[model samples]
Target chain A: MAVSDRSASHLGEAVGLSDEQLIEMYRLVALTRALDERMWVLNRAGRIPFVISGQGHEGAQVAITWPLRKQHDWVAPFYRSIATCLTFGMSPRDILTAQYATANDPSSGGRQMPGHYGSREHNLVSVSSPVATQLLHAIGIALAAKVRGTDQVAMTFMGEGSSNQGDVHEGLNFAAIHKLPFVFVVENNGYAISVPSAKELAVEDVASRAGGYGMPGLVVDGSDVLECYRVATEAVDRARSGGGPTLIEAKVTRLTAHSSDDQQTKYRSEEELASEKARDPLPRFRAQLVDAGILTDHVEQRLGADIKAVVDDATQYAESQPDPDPSTAMRWVYAEEWPSEAPPPWGFGTAGGHAEEH
Target chain B: MPAKTFIEAIREGMADEMRHDGSIIVLGEDVGKKGGVFLATDGLWAEFGDDRVIDTPLTESQIIGTSIGAAINGLRPVAEIQFADFIHPAFNQLVSEAARLRYRSNNGYSCPMVVRAPYGGGVHGALYHSQSVEAFFTHVPGLKVVIPSTPYDAKGLLRSSIRDDDPVLFFEHKKMYRSVRGEVPDGEYAVPLGRAAVTRAGTQLTVIGYGLMAHYALEAAERVADDGISAEVIDLRTLRPLDKESVLDSVRKTGKCLVVYEDNRFGGYGAEVAAIVAEEAFDYLDGPVTRMAGPDVPGVLQPRPRGLVHDQPGEDRRRDPD
Candidate 1:
């Protein structure tokens, strides 16, 4: 059987997921795309500062995120993972609130810049402007889990350009040497800002470098949701089962500019951009659902309408939310209590006495 | 109590902490098997096994970064950087991640780990191996900087650092690893983080210092004592949360103060101490606060530079009855 046929059958066999879960994943992907598009519009309207669109890579993100045990398995995601955050249970309102630097945003309480979302409850690390830094953090988390004898694994996401950074090499080497449970997913979307991957990396396949680190490497079609899910599931399972780390290279296409500040037309030719647009992941995944008799044209149309409504409501709610208080900017610089000088829980000690002196 | 070298006290502190808390682990280059290049972690691998006493690859960034994650995930990790100068590769991890994690996470997470490096000159290790980089970390807010002058303080303060719920940069003087010995308690004990100890009391001048420089300051104080000038010596065990009260108290009583440090004279920790005195106790000063520091440009790159050695600045030199 073909790989798509196998994936379709596997999706049908997976237990505990009702039609609602599948529909929710699809709806989340749609909402993320719409929100990203709206942010681009807002950027033009001077209502938002910046945006990094997650247009084409939504299918693979939604697929992998649907089965994740959020907040349990740590996520060290790259900058282009807005959809992954949403599918993993962050509300659209929260993402929008954070984008607008509102107080209601749980990701950072408006402390961080847009696209640098992190939630303690979600176990999603704060994304930084520096690429590939999260890879080392993921490796560190995985090592901690291994040391603590926890079965949980850390999953790190990155773009193709990040694979060239020294942090990535060190992260993978450390994880592989210690046999730590972790998965590194590289979203290869053909361009890093303006420079093509071919110019940036000597190796055509980023996953092939996994062999040097003594780990299994796999490449899959990122546009196919089911295919991406299957590959990611296998890698995650291998890690959870004590088989060590896996490097997954997801072949994706960038359907938009790198970010609001970027203009892809300046670097990519018109023909190249047109070809990538034609292979957009959303429609391809919907067609696969239709081929499996699980979804029809009417269902897709209804899903699109439902997601658009949700996105509209969330955007309005986010825009209406209050901005963060200026005085609270330095509130979290240190924990409320110093480690050595934490007050007694039951009020046992003298209020201002020097305990260390006695 | 037993007399112990600074290196041995550090090893004992780690062993004691590891024995007490299962969550505490050690990792560094040659820390295990080799027992560390300075033997500060000697016998730890044999005692705690390979799992707890880990020997990491020569990647300083990974060593420091992973320790941050480990500490955040409910493990107390003590990471050694081998030498102070080599910590540059891991500077970003320390400054950005470890130092800022608690602040950025709004107390939801913390990096309660210790980064121990043998710092300062006098061992002839030269450029890469010998450096006093405490000032760099002292400038960082969330990180607590500690420099111990003796074995007792080294062990007790290290134990405190391992238990600290914040990132601490612990500097162990390489020259003092064997040369400096002191009575350290056999039982479990800890030295408070932000307190200074007065090694000696005098009436004329207060000699304020830390790490190996504290020992030098004491030697200079004793030399001055023979000339009948009473010099008070204060050892600042903790650089951050600097026992400013104790420093100010000594400076207030003596009316004259001399801050000494081995770091380069330009922008050194002595400047910070001087700034504090100038800011807090400017009216109490009888004369200008003197500072003795290593000269700029790596101090001539050779020992005993002719005419390079200088005495403490100001008019107090003539007051001695030598």
Candidate 2:
């Protein structure tokens, strides 16, 4: 119930979570980290096209979504929302399929770049490459929920860089004016692509801008999983209880460069990179579980082994899956099978005809 | 059945659909209490209340972006961009998000929302309010661009756009909103998109146009008929899927073609029609297809002597191609 500082307690029990829930949270964090590691390898080996690392971000991403009801509450995720998407019922195989852009990839059938995640079955909105677009979408979903009296909270994620987009301001102002049941979280991982926070945000914290939009804003330590869970749960509860929208700035650390193509070393200082290690949430969360006697050396080894095996199986399954059918490349331009008005001559409504400008 | 103005028919279409289906909600600046800037959504707020008829803050992107979200989730939201000139702010939401929702998601999701904006110049709404931007959107695939010429087509196409399972941009001409009128049936009727109607059939040449231009083309066709120049006028109800057959059939019958539009002549929507005719019906064409469009100006005007509405002081009655 308290808005804790960056040095707040990270204990799962301190947040009233059970030992089993703590262990499950740890497993999810480790799995996301391992899968992200595999994606970088796949990118380097010319197997996959790109990689958007979710390394230092695992804890906050995983914990903030702990209270959300899977397939009931809606989520509008950004590209770096691997842990959040996984927490929302996206499997390890689902991540790999999206990474590989295979025929069965639910996010997009090899159409979009890697890290774009969405699943209607899981109540996740489609993740577009453009940042801050999802903020408006979450606001919209929240508006729909409020209108229907669905008692559901809509949550969305963005980065410090994306917070400056015009859409973010518009979405925040709209949600605030309407008092929509929405939660907007900005995962400030120090830098956006290569632009640091200072260059992106003129203010000290991105949360400070929330005042302009008339919403309650707070900052959270992204590495402290339990604290983030407490904060996000309160925000979601507030939204569902007609308290309107809230903005959260999760101060995470980007463990890797922006993507496979970006080189953070070109701009980031060695000292800054060193500082990110101590803020790495995965190892921090792991050590906390160990210090609490919730996980022993044997259990830790088993957990690591289990995550490695799952990542390996997902990678192999996705690698062997067929690429999106080349012949069906231009499908779903207009909601396929909506009963066309008997398309005109020159095969107007056919796959090739309708895609004249596709 | 009674005759109604284009704007009245549009209001009727939305009101009737909202009565039949509760999911349909209207959201935009002045769309609710103010009944829209042009009164297109007049009286919707009183009937549907604030929940169904929402008056949003003055932001086009939020108006459209939220509608896309609401559409994909459950509600059938009808977002209005106060004017066509102001629609540029939400171009990304429409082109990138709504247009690509189904394709980018690989049919995993679809944005079944309608973004209605009054377009074209006629009421002396200079510069910011008088721009025609249909060509800007018609070029984008996965989006249906419709401009109705008559009240009857407006109501039918309104229902079709509401029921269609994809994003539709419905542009109503400001000049024709109150000026144009036609009988709309009291019962149910829906005009399917991607089709065109030949308002006037002739054999000399095919005049292809949509929106207010379609009505002008029909009048021009009738006038030229008295001069022994038989002209066929084709009203392109839907511009994206574009009744290619109707235009081609007319062009093949009449050896010549002329496309008219109110947008900029340099890159007007009529150019696409001209291109399509040249590409497919090249052999059938007796001569090169031509385009009659607005001059390459920043905005459309009522020509000089602005206040002259039907023979004013010192105003020339004769009209020339500007």
Candidate 3:
């Protein structure tokens, strides 16, 4: 369990992962990348509204979620967590439906902007557009878990830039104080929108802030899935054992610009972008599987083809799904028959005539 | 029925609900041991213990944010923001997370939480302590803003808000907490949301108001009754999805409307009431829809005479047609 930096080793074997599970991880990473690519095309062709790619971070996103119990554990994900959501059981069609803003979108039914993920079936909490707000939500759910005396642990992910938000500090401090079962993971991709990590964080490691809340802080190389899986497993175990929260910073690389409208050329230098591309986790992880003899060029070709087919099918299915009816705009604002006391002249008589006995 | 103060009514209502429903919890600064700044949550910590009546850190965002999470996880959380003015720190949590949780999640999740804060400016508590923030929350579509003027209404409305499916911003007027008293029902009951109560009935002019202004409107109705002017007072219990039918009916009967609020006159909740009346009941109106509200300035910081900061709705009734 030595933390190796970007080098391929037999660490995946040491983690006791089966060959099928490891390959599935690679497939998910590739599928997430391919789906993100499809979204860019859809956005460019005016078929979709927006696209926020999780490029170069899929390895960390999917790997860190390996040790958790899907549909039992809770995840409060940030916008760029497509791979993580996929690992948590969000269908590809769900992501595509959200991208197309169709009626069948599992998360929001075309209500919110793309990249916002939510799925109750998988225990994934609704993620809003505001940065770092998920940290507090994760803590709150964990608080519920603690109050109920359950071993369920909730995890939240944020960007390096979000670490500077007041919510991150307040949530982490509150979680630590209550000894809540939670994990705060920071995907340090070296940039927040256009601001670099240097400007966003005063300390070198985002995990260093964990000490302020009396939590264990660990930094893992985001490109190495094995290292992230190992750390995430430990953090989850510690939280379930009543050890409180742990702050883990996965140092990752962002291959693409922030969103569809952003252009890295404006703020990020070409050399820096090129260097990050060279260390892209997709190819690096693929190389690791190849060196481990678990994957050959032929298996890689088949996985790539299968992922492309899945993405294509999802794109076509979501694109054909009908858009939400404009008349249903006020559907979820309140529950059905809510504000139970209807305005007068339309009701039996007075406003309180039929007050519910609850 | 028990005659109780507005704050006592609130505490009793929540305690009663918590007794029946194990999921209901109160969390905020001083909500536990200190029993809240104004004791609005008095005896709750002792009854429900620290777990149910939590004492959170002195941060508005943490209280609101955590409440949203708790609400989503099968718990009905009532978060108390110390004062209305201090709610700004949690604006993002309310508007983004709590308010929109249901709509964004497409009914997959809902934040059934109530954020209770004391509002209004009568005790000369100054800018930060005494301010009305209902106008800001009323503009958000997914949120329900409730202001109860009497002890009875406070208990009923708060109980109803706790059972509501959407996020509710309950603004308890600071001046009315102890000053306003009435008989609250002893048995289980809830005042339904999205309805207005006609506190005082009349026929000449319909005076629509909420919170402290509603009390002032009732006084104005009584004073105008001394004259030949029959002033009908409508207490708007819920601000959003505003009991429009009640308002339009009152306006149609009275043929005139006067909307009153404690917030600033410019871009205040009263303006919306006036606009709705003007748009829907314009043909029935005998005169223009008048509005009585606080001046369009930041809340007063210095000590002032009895009613300098807030509008005197009863005095404004003097301008009624002779």
Candidate 4:
């Protein structure tokens, strides 16, 4: 994971991204990190019950979404896809609303647990707690796009651990057979909770298994924002052109323990911990920008202050929002008034009295 | 109006809807070219072609999981699980994903899809094929469970389920696919959900059942009628949001109850029916509520299902309604 300190800004230039766009990319990565840090603080203060973080995954998450069409393509993100959601047009206010679980939280109106990112407005499918269940959903989106003959591509993510799930196999196989317009990303952040990748997957790389499904499997340096973006653009183009699905395994580092609940010391030794911390992508991207002369001391200071203010305001706004109405607890289980002509949604109105009708 | 078999009515319902709305798609194992294992989806592939009528790989989870995603994107999907027995593999997808989609999204999203599976036993198809699985899904609140006993009801209910903007589990009894026939209107009709159909009238006892058991209850009701005892039969078309008032009303008038099902007796669907009778209509004086269901075994054995239909306690003497 050695990031070249030399002028690595040329990476984005090769992909025709401007210096301003590259700076914005670093800003989003920093924003996701800052928002993640705020959630951890809220969880520890007993203000929020739980937290699922995207601290170390911001690089790949942000860059992969940069290549897709906003609001047109679909995203079926995993629980730790904060940067992806934000990069896909979800604001910090929206994310914080879900964390505080207010009635206005667009994800589920306080119904779903926080970090399970989804928004119909952004074409993000609702997430299921069960691992790998969203993979088929992403494929289904791609199937609909293909059926309608639309040039829309769908992207979905999974952890290295859930990659072993049956739905992954079924989804990848189906997408390949149909040559679906899809990009299946495995954010290989080294562990599935307490289980490391070695135990979860027998193979070294998750992308290697893609060959079995007759698709190209590419392993990228997830911390390299420009490199990740380049690979995603290629996949998205191939999907739109009907070249079929691609598996991109981005090897990321889990900067924190799995979640707030997990203890890092229980599983990893001090030496292994130091190794993961050294590969933190946020600082690498920041230094990469500085070396390329795109980021100056004054500009970096202003950016830092701006990000902090946004997070603080979003936090205050969400905390002030009211909890959902208690009376609405039973609402939305079934559509109370779905259009139906058949006897108009009956309720055994006649009951025993109906015996005389015949 | 023309008389149609149960299987024919189901196909016509899907076909009729597909013609009007271009968003509906049907996908499952062997459903396309093979026309479904029981010919329930026969002639649909030719009409809709490959894009609409898709034959998927042998993956049950994807069949349902894919439908859930498709439904969210505005393409109403009707996914078929070949048999109710094979549905266990996709249990997480249906219950965790499809059923909870709308609720979890707080109505921001709706999974307008139908999971059609053939359930129930009586066809000499032993263990694997014969199972009554309505009780499992009926417990799920967000889902609507519809089981039609007649051809007319099947066509009508199928139309309603497809149009309804929520996840529905439409379990058609495999035994009635060909054996049962009824007059289906030439055009469109829908049987409203969450209502009970009283197939026969009586006062001696209330016989509550659904699917194939409801048909069997009618025959059993006629048998007791010869002895000057009337047995009212209630066919619960929709099981989840049960037609409770109908069940209670029949039990209150008859003063006795017999809850029947082909599934296991211990904690089966009939147990809930009997519980409803004992809870709501308790004031009506009569003998104890009865349940005639299959034993709590793995599946149906030969002679077990047929004998279960006629197997009733000696109760020709009418109960007192006080």
Candidate 5:
């Protein structure tokens, strides 16, 4: 399919999501929070080695991804994108398997550390430990879409810290120059590991740099699910319609420390922490749904219990799964086979074992 | 077949592949209009359009990062890093990303890309332009490092590297680019990634080297032939996934080996090759494996005027069985 001729009506009134879609998105966000909390407990109990919680950024991640064409659009998610990945297609079991580093983990097959997520079915490009690299990878995916004449758009998430990376600039410039179907979402959750956003950039907002790349810059209230969804829907529609890339700065809160290893209280004051807590997207979103009568207290209670059960079952199942064999660890280091003769018409089979259709 | 310089051979190799495979793309600083600083990518832009032969920003990270991304997305991207010395900025992409992509993704994705850079000294490039960067990548497990000594090998190895499923670091010596000429076949052909060539046959001692050092080793062998010492010269075209069979066979026949390389003597690529011989063919050795390499110093401080350079390993290619 080529760029759609659909009008602005594609972005309907009142954030444009049906009740079912809204509830689904809320369920994903709640499940993500539940799983992230379980990971912390597992890490503390010495069951799982590490955990990178996606607690505070869930609202922005879930809202932005809710409008995406799940298996069609590609997502190169950052480490702090549990809610995002879950919203895309990753099941709770798949996520917990990754955290457990089990053989069943589709992302890395238990090879990589927890939080590195990928799946072809979900159209999520695998990422590395290095920050900002995935943005260029996403740009490449978009380039592929542009070259192949497909309507597929690519998006990647990054922390405010990764905005300072050189790859980020290159990715943005390349995407703008090529007019590729892409979107860059900077989830500005204040601090990157320990360094604050003030130290990361001179500008007040990360979106301010978009003008230099000749793309539209957007600043969204990340805590407001409807606001993030509206901005993301517009960006997605624009990108899918051959309108090129858009830089969206999602001003979210980092409710938890950077990871299980970090301590926010050391850097952030009690007053600052309390203020951020008051604006926590989870409870705020729940309250909004309740006041609107879209969600009752009974539904909220049942949903919470259901999400908790799902997270608990996933953690137990993942823990029960076998770890990857150390002897077979060297399997994927090199491709299964190099082209002994001439490669096929597309050169795709020369690597990655599978032969994909052109 | 036609006689071609090392640069022309590389260009021809990439061009031939580009003609055969539509997915192959080239990008780097000035790789499009300028045809690369070394002219290795000459005429590629005119032959292919701007889309295929991309002129990228001077940012090394972008060049490599994009290449890795493109490769993973089904493009065979050969990214040029202008000079080997200027490749540190792209090191993370090459090492942590490109090299590890196939493995880390459990073969779900692969980086079938080539990172070609001009390396070595002798043309007075000094610091930023002159360097032997093979040692840094040789330690990396997933990377295949190729350094060819002749036009024939340069063309063949580069073509194979572009076709290989793994990420290959093709380091063409700057000294050999224009100066080194040899017969390169016109039709498609490729020298495999893990094989070494016995450039010169001899029975006395085996001399091993790669890139320009291998060329110099042949010259040294010719000079030593007059004194009745038949030094078997072996050119290690690919540094990693080393041609252990060729190295062992030559060492077994000659009973001694002397490795020569332009990289610093300490922790050089030559050291690993020397150690391979010591470990695998130790029983067949007649004497200790010796290495004649550049001293452990920065490129700027090295003596100039080529031959006047005091620590030139090409001058030290003698057999010492003791």
Candidate 6:
């Protein structure tokens, strides 16, 4: 629990995670990373259509997702939140199946363009391709929770460039004004597509705008899983207690291109990419565990082997799954009819004639 | 029962809904202290206080977007956009967010909200103040578009929209705000969305329209009736969840159709009605469907008297020959 504490602890005390929990977190992160890598491979092979890698974001994602009560609280995640989704109990099979656009994909049933996954059971709203759209949606969900007198809070994830969107500002303003229970997590990986963060805004930190909205802003080392867990826990707790929204800026690194279609070398120099690789969050956390004696080389090797087996099985299962039926494309466009007087028009059923010509 | 103009009926409807449901709130620019630019939300600020009848900043996006959030949060919000032309800034929120929320969420939730704006061109309000944007919203599913031609339907349909579980784009014709008047009952009444009202039944031609164009159609129907031609006038109260049954029934009975709308002829709501008539009741048609609409050219600023003349009938003739 020393890692959960706010005070800084040396690498010695941090490695005391129960062996089981450490292995579980590490395995989940590894599966998420592997799933993303395999997705890129599929994209290259033209087997799958699109891919957005969650590389270098595993630590913060795993840490932030650990404390939240899935199926109770809501998550409005961005496209880059694969690791976060994995930590939130989405099976590796589910992620890979969705990537492969298979029928068994629980999130969207292969209907949505890949990566726009959502599950009502898990309280995760479907992700849209429009950047920063989820910010307002999260605020709206939190506001609904507030009005319904529920203790539930919503967490909205976005990137550094999304901070420049008007919807983001409007969302934060509304959340602050209404004191809605929610948190804004900006996974600042330094670049939005080809544009660098410096070219997007005057402020270096996206969290700095929280003050303008009369909310608390915290900047945390995104590579440090312990720091992420502690900050996210405090923020979620505050929101649940009706202390309003908190803006958390997670300083992570984007180890892969924005998407499989992107080439990071065009925008970032080789030296910068090399430095970022050196600070890769997974290896850093692993080193910390080793230095603390919480994990020995033997245990680490076994954990890796277990993770590989799980990911391999999931990938194979997903690859073998059947693609969705083309006719089912129109299914999720609207909800099924409820018992209301005027139910949604599901299919093309024309109403009987009652027209008058004037 | 009492005679009231379209604007008065709208005001009465908001006041009644506010009195009936504590959760109902009205917010927009100049909607509170100023009683709205068109006075459609008049006198309610005094009764509901500042919280329920709020005057928001001059941000259309926030006005409509916040209303969506508020609506989802159990508050029945009626957001006024001052004029229909100014709604472009908030168009994304309406189309992408509000319209899709219920559909995308699989009906787990709904946005019970109304965006009220005065539309049409007869008032000589020129470019920004007048434009029929209903076509834009009508194309978007999960949104109910309502345009009332009289006081009674305005009051009844506005009430229904407030209680309904879908986002409604309520277009109030600026020209008919005071020009159109009818008896609206004092007691609570709800005119269901998607149901058209037959203002006058005839046999020669089925004249179809809504809002200000409905009034014109009524007038034209009367003139045609004087000439020994029977005209059935149908007021399409809601555009999206269109009263297709009523429309097809009228077109079938009359065997002829004339659709009128104030928006440009190209890709207007009238085009949708024409397509439906051709597809569903084509065999019964006696003549080709005709449409009367505004000019395709962008509105120009006219000097005094010329501007006043633009507000008058026959000033700017319909660009379409039909």
Worst 10 residues of 4 chain A by lDDT: A349-358
Residue A240, model 5, lDDT: 94
lDDT by residue (B196-275, candidate 3, tens digit) is 99998899999999998888889878987888899999999888758777988989999999998878889998898898
Which window of ten consecutive residues has the lowest lDDT sum in model 3 chain B?
A: B313-322
Estimate every model's Cα lDDT from 0 to 1: 0.80, 0.86, 0.85, 0.86, 0.83, 0.78
Question: A1-358, model 4: which lDDT tens digit per residue?
Answer: 1122324357557987877788788899999999999999999998887898887899999999999998999999889999999999899998999888899999999988888778999988777689899999999989999998878899999899999999999889999999999999999999999988888888999999999999999999989988899999999999999999999999999988888889989998989988887678899889887887777786788789989999999999999999998877767787866232222245444333221111
Candidate 3 deviant stretches above 4 angstroms? A1-10, A297-301, A338-358, B307-322
Candidate 1 is scored at a TM of 0.90
| TM-scores of the candidates in the order shown | 0.90, 0.94, 0.93, 0.94, 0.91, 0.85
Q: Which stretches of candidate 2 lie over 4 Å from their true place?
A: A1-10, A338-358, B302-322
The sequence of per-residue lDDT tens digits that candidate 5 reaches over residues A148-195 is: 666888899999998899888878998898888899999998888788
Tens-digit lDDT track for model 1 on A73-149? Answer: 88877778988888666788878887887886777777777887777778787666677777877887888888889
In the predicted model 2, the residue pairs found to clash are: none
lDDT of 4 at B157: 90
Best-to-worst TM-score order: 2, 4, 3, 5, 1, 6
lDDT of 2 at A167: 91
Better of 2 and 5 by lDDT: 2
Better of 2 and 3 by lDDT: 2
Q: B304 in model 2: Cα distance from truth in Å?
A: 3.0
Q: lDDT of candidate 4?
A: 0.86
Write candidate 2's Cα lDDT for A215-246 as tens digits: 99999999999889999999988999999999
Interface RMSD of each: 4.6, 2.1, 3.9, 4.0, 6.5, 4.9
What lDDT does model 3 reach? Answer: 0.85
Q: Rank the candidates by DockQ, best first.
A: 2, 4, 3, 1, 5, 6
lDDT of 5 by residue, B1-322 (tens): 6798888899999999999998999989888878987787889999998888988877788888878767766688899998899999988888899889877877778888999998877665777667888999999878889998888888889888999988999998877777667999898788887778898999989999888888779888998999999999999888877767678888999999999988888999889888989997999998999999886778735335444333343443221111
